[model samples]
Target: MKAVLVGILVGLATASPVSLHRDPWDPTIKLPSPTQQLVWGDVNVLHTTDIHGWISGHSKDVYPEKSWSGNFGDFYSFVTHMRQKAMTKKSDLLLIDTGDRRIGHGLTDHIFDPKKANGQDA
Candidate 1:
């Protein structure tokens, strides 16, 4: 776990970032590609956290906001590819998501009327 985190940090630190999506609504931003090739072991973990209800991801063309343009479908595609890679390598891959379901963002917070099932309608 520690090694994976370190690898990601190093990748982020050394690589020139880029954006993956080219949606009309999303701002043009470069996606990040790791400078160093990531090492895969017999067992691997792919983790995601926070999210803060950014299912559609950041649409604004601002600095940090534009970076996370890939949405849930993109995330699913990535996981699928990773799973296929792990299968070919005969390794175990696990995906974990720490909580924080619906907290921020207008999609989750403001789209639904609170009076309707305490936002369960969302």
Candidate 2:
């Protein structure tokens, strides 16, 4: 119970709810300003899961979906920045990825295989 609460708090601190500019192509996309100030604790952890080969990002510019459409590289940059923030604050932050990277886009799920059915498995 406490862990869940901590997780929520940690997430809120690290991200602005809608963190990145997911779709720069869309002209009408409205991004919200980050209002939450980070309150780093002694220990913190960030976990990402259920990616399903979406390590790239959302290609189509759809509502709500576009909010989290940044690629893994973007995510890495975000985490790196946050980690730096934690270091300045003298807090410990850990990043954990529990995603099952399978079941994804054509480029990843298909592409090179002769069958094009089973991709590079874990």
Candidate 3:
């Protein structure tokens, strides 16, 4: 019982809450005016490349690859939310994409059946 109580107390002290709030009029906390701040002094950049059709995630269900299969739609939503958060915190944020943009998939290939020769009989 004593050990469990100690563990609970330790966890509570070390845990960080998801959100924090400060009193707006607190004299010690001076909000910086726009003119006094450097707009891009400290910036954060995110880059993704060679993504291919991975927007739907890799098909293989193994370890790290399995973990990433969460899909591109989730990633886009995450980025949108994070950018909004960065803007709220008055920080510079940039996202970049690079490399080949082609999508290779059965859906794309089947658009024109290969069995038909020269748009005529197979």
lDDT of 1 by residue, 71-102 (tens): 88898999999999999999999998763434
lDDT of 2 by residue, 21-62 (tens): 455446785666889976789998888776765678887667
Which residue pairs in model 1 clash with each other?
18-30, 18-31, 18-32, 19-30, 19-31
Model 2 poorest 10 in a row by lDDT: 113-122
Off by over 4 Å in 3: 1-41, 101-122
Strongest candidate by lDDT: 1
lDDT of every predicted structure (CA atoms)? 0.74, 0.71, 0.65
- In order of appearance, the predictions have TM-scores of 0.55, 0.55, 0.45
Candidate 1 regions exceeding 4 Å error are: 1-33, 101-122
lDDT assessment of candidate 1: 0.74
Q: Model 3: clashing residue pairs?
A: none
Q: Candidate 3 lDDT, tens digit per residue, 34-122?
A: 87653443577778666656767779754446546757788788889868877887887888765332433333334644345234563
Model 1, TM vs. native:
0.55
Worst 10 residues of 3 by lDDT: 100-109
